[model samples]
Target chain A: MTSPAITVDRLTKRFGAVTAVDDLSFTVAPGRVTGFLGPNGSGKTTTLRMLLGLMQPTSGQAIVGERAYRDIRRPAQLVGAALEASSFHPGRTGLGHLRTLAPQVGVKDARCHEVLELVGLSGAKKRRVGGYSMGMRQRLGLATALLGDPSIIILDEPANGLDPQGIAWLRGLLRALAADGRTVLVSSHVLAEVQQSVDDVVVIGGGRLIHASTLLEFEELASRDVVVRTTDYQAVETLVRERGWSFDAQLDHHVVHDVAAAEIGAALFAAGLEVHQLADHGADLEAVFLRLTESSDAPTTQFTGSASAAPAAPPAPAAPPVDGTVAPPPPPAPPTTGGVA
Target chain B: MIAALVAEYRKFFSTRLWWILAIVMVAYLAFIAGVFGFSLTVDTGADAQASNFLSPKEIAQSIYALTSPIGYVFPLIIGSLAVTSEFRHKTVTGSLLVEPRRSMLVVAKLVSSIPMGLAYGVLATVTVVAAGAPVLELVGDGAFLGDGDVIETLVLSVVVMALWTMMGVAFGTVLTNQVAAIVVVLAFTQLIEPIARVALGAFDATSEVSKYLPGAAADALLGSSFFSSFGGEGGGTDLLPQWGGAIVMVTYILVLAVVGRLTTFRRDIG
Candidate 1:
């Protein structure tokens, strides 16, 4: 069966006086990967934990399909999640961990092998989890999460510890899983990885929802990205930062976003620097996310999109400061499309 | 609930902790029972003779008794770890994820713990007998295993040990922290309860209460205990009947589970 939509309705969670999640709500649609994006300490994990019923919301509800998670009948058969990659018991073998979860979801023990192979851990199935690397443990965690073949899969930082090739593989895998009509919500602080994978995004900061939008809106914002390579790389970087526009550093030079390419060329030519590779590689979700999260020029608010309506972009950089500090963003998008290098 | 139970059982097999501790328990108890048996038979020096735990004849009747109580510690650790390990390893997230209903999860752990405890109890029971019987034959005057009472005592000892295990799991479920649960289990089962029984028995008024303690009840249910022999102001004649003690032990397990279901187990897992 395909996954049903996940809806969060004014979910508020307070640990003592500190609210980890404040009156937040959003919908995660089936047949697409929804990126649960936030900076560190943004309450992403806390919210996910609440959704899975690992933690209780101080008020309100997170619903899976028609009912709350706790009220969901045969929940194991409907939802699967890996809230953290380190959830596997250290002494258990990879296969053993899945076996432990299989019967709970009413899946057969043989499914253990099926998932072990699916996650590429069949060879190391017998090896104790303690000996596995971070990447291997992540795979085992994924294996366990998928043990039941649930319709909705939630993974927090699923690409963490994976090498670049593995990250690429994960990108395809998540898309593939979503293509199968399952609801997949993947949480990550690193925007670069998630942007390529997710179809929709729900961003939160300071325990409140900042924006809910599709990936293309973010990509459209990113398409305005301009890269500049000059003799004096440092000079262009300082110029971009001084203008208050975000920039990401790279091996050759830097990629600057939000500002026009004409503005960048004008600044560099006026500075009398040798320009080599000033190109438009388009902005990614990373650029859009920083604009939405980092700029704390206003108080926070949430915007959820309709089924057919486009996502309303929040103020660039943030509804509020992610940490009340507009730290620098990640390096500019890799020159993947047309490059002038 | 049954699915939860099956998951809990699978969890026991998945982790190496259970079986590793089980083997360690069996080996240690077997070695100790054999040593106790050999030492009791010969007229050792004053210190060794003073340490003589049971007569060879007593050893034959309670062949499973000597090291059986010590082996209770393993099952207690197992039962407690069953709950605490989930938190320690962060598998509690996965567990609750797989089974969202906390009450059913608690029930499953409770139901599954009995059989797991029995698994530990059975291994220890078998080891106690396997290691003790031959030593009893070499040292005791009577033929070992001659009476039906020996088998009954062995069976009761295993049952009581299993009960202790379930109790440990209850403590674990309620405590939530692994180290805290271990400390309490050891301190209470190994020291506090035993010492409390002896300390409280000093007062006639409190002596009646001591008999109702888990340790005292366990002794009563098993029909014999080393501590109960100190009958004056330091021991109890006030303990309930064997069946009553069993009921009291079950009550303790039930109270912990019900209280946990109401509080700790229902709290946020992460």
Candidate 2:
């Protein structure tokens, strides 16, 4: 495989007694969007800051290209970053801010205009950044990051404060950037957003990496709990009770245990039961995320986009099961670091 | 270095603060020169005003001399503003991230300050010259300062302003808050240095130490002729001799700038 565009090696950072990033390690390759997923204050920001060399890592190192970020002779052209949308001189126009950063990255001034247009900020380029709404600021921030045509882009919650259209625009932009063979590492708590945009996932909790893999792989690993919903809910639930199957109840529907769809279909036919739905329900990123990060006292989860990387546990065992039914044992998947997969 | 320098200049000029501050400096200089011009003209009268035989340089010098006291403040603002503004806006993080080799940026900031400081000095110098023209014409060419003196003064003014700008940079690095930097710079200029110098002067044993004080050093660089009366032995009042002041000031700037840049590398920007 080609060298990862970004490689963070056992990085650690501390602010006084609080350890922000603890021995975190990951690699983001080119041609893909790697979702750096974590909850708030979970060391995601600190790790990103260290990756860009905005903050000194207490130990370890972050490499962009072949060198550490601090050692890169022309960093802007190598790795473009947008950490905070509000980090700008309020009195300066958006165009002015871009112009200043463009030359530093060795890009032509025209690139600024091009990027402004790319991020849909062309019409507002002349406006002072202070006057911009958060959504507009985020777009402008993205434009700045793209100005240099960097080989790698690192954005911390770049989609924050964006409307649906803005988020969609950002998702498409990231995809296009990755298509051009650039590495895009975006950190956010929104799994759904990452679900829609990212190609790979790097999941972390409590300042530790949980797992890293392709998007589909992370989904399978993180959401192993099979959800089954049927209109003949009472009959199915009663059947589950008779068999001592444990499951969560739903409004207007019944969610049974990990019973395989094929087995359920045959049993329902044999019992002369008609069902509206018997499809196997896969876990959404939200459920997997909450399940993976549920230590009660765990740091507040900031959902940039919903994407998970660890295999989830089955529902509680106390509920009754239905006749001729057994939850399919987890999906046949690769070994997970922290969960049974 | 060129890329970083260009970036520094771009960031410096793109902000509204620089323009507004420039306007304020121009207005203040014009007002001061106007007052000096009128005074010199009224003293010399209309006959001298018509002959226009006066030396333009001396009139320019005296007008500039009166105006020079105010000159330091603006360049100080420029220096502090250049560095402190980045902290104020939190763009320092973005700037450093783009070029993590921060020492080069500090150097670029110092290099860029020269041209900017020169520009402000030229504006103030030209305003004094332009305003002093009528006064020179009125005072007779004899009262007009020679070109040698004018050139020397202008060059000295530029260098002095540049040094102060660098000093302000050091100050800004030492104190990231713009208001606090301004306050400390102002306090040093108005109170701290003066008090320190005065207190130091009272004791003959430590009087020599006062010459190296920041205020005295800056005063020497401006080629102020009045330093001898400030208690130092005639030649000692100047922290450095004619050309030595620039070298000394540059050294101070280099040392402080390096310290500032090193400090920045170790900072964990939030």
User: After superposition on all CA atoms, what RMSD does each candidate show versus the true structure?
Assistant: 7.7, 7.3
Chain A of candidate 2: what's the TM-score?
Answer: 0.81
Q: What shift in Å separates residue A191 of candidate 1 from its native position after superposition?
A: 1.1
DockQ of each: 0.68, 0.67
User: lDDT of all predictions, in order shown?
Assistant: 0.75, 0.71
Regions more than 4 Å wrong, model 2: A1-3, A221-233, A257-270, A273-281, A296-341, B33-63, B131-143, B194-206, B225-240
Alpha carbon lDDT at B32, candidate 2: 72
* Ten residues in sequence with the least summed lDDT for candidate 1 chain B: B228-237
Model 2: per-residue lDDT, tens digit, A1-341?
Answer: 23257888888887888867767777887778999887777788889888877788889898888888888777787788899988999989999998888777888888999988988888999999999999999988888888777788999999899999988888998888888888899989878877788998887766666557788877664333344556577787777677676667778666555566677677767767777776676546676565555421132322222233222322213322212323223223422122211
Native-referenced Cα lDDT, model 2:
0.71
Clashes per prediction?
A: 10, 34
Fraction of true A-B contacts recovered by candidate 1: 0.88
TM-score of chain A of each: 0.75, 0.81
Instruction: Indicate the TM-score of model 2.
Output: 0.83
